[model samples]
Target: MVLSAVLLFGASSVTSLNGVFAQDSVDEISESVGDTVDNAASDISDAVTDEESESTTQEHGEMVHDDEGRLPGNIKIEREPTYKVGDDVQINATHMPGMEGAEGTVIAAFDTTAYEISYTPTDDSEPIENHRWIVQEEIAEAADQEDADAPFEVGDEVTVEAYHMPGMEGATATIDAVNETTVYLVDYIDTESGEEVINHKWVTEDELATLDGAEETAPATSESTTESSEDESESEESSSDEESGSESDSTPEENSDEESSEESTPEESSSQDSSSEETE
Candidate 1:
């Protein structure tokens, strides 16, 4: 009986130990799974955060590039440009946001040869395409050369001297197009933000249109003349009505006096007849 009791006690202790071991294993596995899930979630969150940060940085860089408003110094001015200063225009350039289809006023005009260029930015940003209106003087090589009058051909690689945006100056660029047209500096209100943009440089003639329905003043002058004529006619009619009213009033008084005189003449005739009858 003592041997059987001892054997039962050892068996119970081993079962308890096994149960503890199994529970510990389960706990370790659960802890490990929880840690792995947490690590995965942290990694995904970090990746999403990094992507958002990169996107925001890129957008901010672009906005900085687009909002550069400083004017280039010593640019050649165009004499007798088709669009003069203070003339209202419609812009069709998509170089900046809210620039396309915006109404603008011409502030300055230049006669230089404008070039459309493509370039890789110096700040390792995305490549710019067909940037408009870099003049002959804005090219480092061309400005240094004796023949500054010579324009760059399409696909010709040249160094930029204009700092229209960040990373533009001192960067190498390829000319995509050339134009001898007038380039204008303009002021406009942004279509999206309603903010005033002043001294915006380098919109070409083809990208601008005269304000729709603009005219020199023939129609306006004619309308004013017609209004004045109507006013004069109305005043003449009023004066004539007053004069006619006064004349009508005076004529009635004259008729009454004439009737009185005629009545007096009939009384005189009856008196003469009575005097002649008395004499007879």
Candidate 2:
């Protein structure tokens, strides 16, 4: 009986040992599998993060036109009391965003009065329906100065060169008007919050500089240069129109040659026509 008891106890101990070893092996495999899953998840997360970063970078990289086609900087509008067309001057009006102290090399200086105008935003969900700025009737080339944002009516597309709202900068905006009264850098207080908005706005020609350059008088030579440029532009336009007419009419010499050849070779024309039909 004692021997029988010893045998029973030994068998039970063996079974307990086998159970512990099987459980340990299963635990080890589960731990390794968990580690692998974690590593895979981390790699996927990192890849997603990298892709998002690259996409954001590319979106901000390519900005060509400024909010107003002017170069980057805060530009001030300067008014010359005696301004006119083809005047050389710098803008000193604190009307340009980021250009209060910055200098503007005149792209075109005018003497007539300037006015700030408005336009409806083209971008979806943009807040500015009619943004106000400057237009001078003297400088505006459009047919009407009072029509708000002439380009809006005329369908001239324009990209944004300035920003009135965050993310509005670098976003392509449409041109609404080409000509108007004086433009201004405006400081409008939001009725709800009283925040300052610095929109580099456009005004009339009179709103700009007459003699905005370094306050020094230009020599009479400048007048001659301006006149010459105007003449050249007129000449260019005329030349362009002539070229278009010539192209539309066929080269005059080529047409004459064609007529002469047609008279000489009516048989050849018929033969060629027959050949084309055969090929078809």
Best by lDDT: 1
Could you tell me how far off, in angstroms, the CA of residue 276 lies in candidate 1 after the best superposition? Answer: 67
Candidate with the greatest TM-score versus the true structure: 1
lDDT, each prediction: 0.84, 0.48
Question: lDDT per residue, candidate 2, 181-250, as tens digits?
Answer: 4333322322323333323344344334544343544655688889999999999999999999989888
What root-mean-square deviation over C-alphas does model 1 reach? Answer: 9.3
Off by over 4 Å in 2: 62-280
Q: Model 1 residue 193 lDDT?
A: 65
Q: Give the Cα error of residue 153 in candidate 1, in Å.
A: 0.8
Clashing pairs in 1: none
Worst 10 residues of 1 by lDDT: 60-69
Q: lDDT score of model 1? A: 0.84
Off by over 4 Å in 1: 1-70, 213-218, 222-280
